[model samples]
Target: MIQPFIRVDGPAAALPEENVDTDIIYPARFLLITARLGLGPYAFHDRRFRADGTEVAEFVLNRPEWREAPILVAGANFGSGSSREQAVWALLGRGIRCVIAPSFGEIFQANCYRNGVLPITLPPAQVAALSAAAAAAHPFAVDLEAGTVTVAGRPPIPFSVDLERRLALLNGWDETATLLNAYGADIGTFEERHRRHQPWLFEGENDA
Candidate 1:
């Protein structure tokens, strides 16, 4: 679960490219694991490390200052491939509480919610400006409640998330929990009706 709202403070860097798929975020080889173990070290597998197992200094995440980036300022259409929930888990596991991009893959955004990561959307220009500002200052702030991002002591810029998604993140509710809450009364009614129509299925009512 995530706190309703918290300010994110960390160095920010830009991916500055679109269609960043799950494999790039968490490689396919790392998949097939039940527990989210040892995944953080490999997050951004291709971009952060080379095939021979050496760091790619050019990648933003490979830098020492940006490794624990609490707020990720990225390009448009981030998280654009397979709907692997592990990607979200890997990100949250790595201490990245929030992602600020112009847009996100539909399924990937939902996955973020399930794993307690908040993905925010902003204008393309705004993302570029924030990325630049973050480079100047090691730590920046992303206020989930205020829906604002402040970098380099600049004025806050507003961002938005889907209303339903925002509500889920705020309450730390996943899809199953949300559905159960929405259908609580209906489920009770159905159970009562089932007992009446099929008394044999009810433990107490079926006694001979």
Candidate 2:
């Protein structure tokens, strides 16, 4: 996942109320071990598409206007359910940059960060206003640096993110990235010392 703090380049729209889970975002059948190819099409499997395998035209994502949505303005406790990183991957693959809601599931929120998606939380009024703007417009932009979400004529609405996650997303970092940076030199030194102390660990120069 690439961690670049970008201006969210489209309108933000709140999802329908409540309990939007991982399975809704990405179904279990698609969770096979295959690499992430083609997951974007199945992004919101059962919601955007019907049980008969047809498009649900009335769904927010099914609407042509929302095809390029970059920020999701969702209700409280969004992304709740089984811990599946694939849900976050699907959202990212489909070009969603950030999600705004009153709250998010802890696991889902962590997955979002790991996958390089920014999750923003705002009050209920702000969420409603943003969703309304998205319904009325095409592309709204959220400037991460400025901490503002701007639509055509509305006041630039402010938003907030957790400090640690914000820094990680802005820098395109996950736990591994943080660890590597923090301990790279020390780890390298330790490896060298270990090799010297335990000669039997290496059988020959070929092993080195």
Candidate 3:
């Protein structure tokens, strides 16, 4: 099971560029990497590295302090263009558990939640404030229960998540887990009803 996301206590970073696509997040060439682990080095490969494979020090993530930041405050449409789950994996590889942005690609946002990442959609102004805070390398605390993000020396910023997704994150439940938890007994009852109506379907089983 994925770790429950009650809270995240760690440093944060900012990437203020708009419309960063999934391929940019995890370059298409590296898609051969089916494994979700060890994708940190490839996250924003072209943006963070040169043709010869040296680090691009100018990139915020390549900087020493922001390298391990677990929270990212990004610009509008942070993850757009494709339905690549690997993009979220790459972010996870960088220890990023939460991403704050004004908006995101629908598929990428859903992928984040399913993969144990929190994609917080805040107002543009709020996102900018968080970005500023991240630029200062302030540690952040995201309390899922409280629905707020707290940065050092600042008042808690409120955000909203879908109740279902929120519950899944808090309980560490994926889609299947959530469904089974919510309807396992109902499903059992329905199966019994179906078996009674069609005994032949359960001929080998103890339908009696």
Candidate 4:
């Protein structure tokens, strides 16, 4: 199971470009590795490094102060491409615990929650404001329980998440765990009822 996401307090990195797909986040060349460890160095591989392997000086993540930021303030439609769980793995590998954006690809957003990354969706104006604040090298605080993003000079910004997703993140439960916790008793009762009503369905199991 992943770590629960309760609160994060740290510097924020800004990726202002829109429609950043999974391929951009964790280029397809690195997909062969099943283990999540060591994926951080390859995140944004093409955009962050030149062919000679030198870091791109202007890339937001390459900047001195933002290099280790734990929160990402991003643009609309972030994580827009293929439904690769590795994209979320790469970010988590890099220590990014939360991502704030105006919108996100549906599958990518789901994957984020499953892996303990909090993806917060706010209004466009709010996202832009947070991006600007992060660009200024300000630290931000994300409270999953409070549903607020707080920067020093601005008022706390509120964002919305589905109740189930929020609980999953707060409690560190993945999709399967969440479902089992929600319906385990009901499922067991149904199985017992079905067995009584259809004894012939179980008759061949003992005979073998």
lDDT string for model 2 (68-94, tens) is 777888888888988988888889888
lDDT of 4 at 198: 95
What lDDT does model 1 reach? Answer: 0.78
**What overall lDDT, based on C-alpha atoms, would model 4 receive against the true structure?**
0.91
Q: How big is the RMSD of model 4? A: 3.8
Model 4, 56: alpha-carbon shift in Å?
0.5
lDDT of 1 by residue, 1-208 (tens): 4545446767776677788888788888878787864567767878877889988897887777787777787778888888888888888778888888889998998777777788888888888877777665446888777888777557888887777777777777667877897998999899889989987778665444
Error of 1 at 4 (Å): 4.5
Q: Number of clashes in model 3?
A: 0
Q: Distance (Å) between predicted and true CA of 48, model 2?
A: 1.4
lDDT of each: 0.78, 0.79, 0.90, 0.91
* C-alpha positional error of residue 17 in candidate 4 after TM-score superposition, expressed in Å: 0.8
How high is each candidate's TM-score?
A: 0.82, 0.82, 0.86, 0.87
lDDT of 4 by residue, 1-208 (tens): 6899999999999998899999999999889898977788888899999999998999999999988999999999999989998999889989999999999999999899889999999889988989999999988999999999999777888888899889888998778866798899999899789989998887768643
The local lDDT score (0 to 100) that residue 43 gets in candidate 4 is 83
Q: In candidate 4, list every pair of residues with a backbone clash.
A: none
Cα deviation of 147, candidate 4, in Å = 1.1
User: Model 3: runs farther than 4 Å from truth?
Assistant: 181-208
Number of residue pairs clashing in candidate 2, backbone atoms closer than 3 angstroms, sequence gap of 3 or more or interchain: 4
Top model number, TM-score: 4
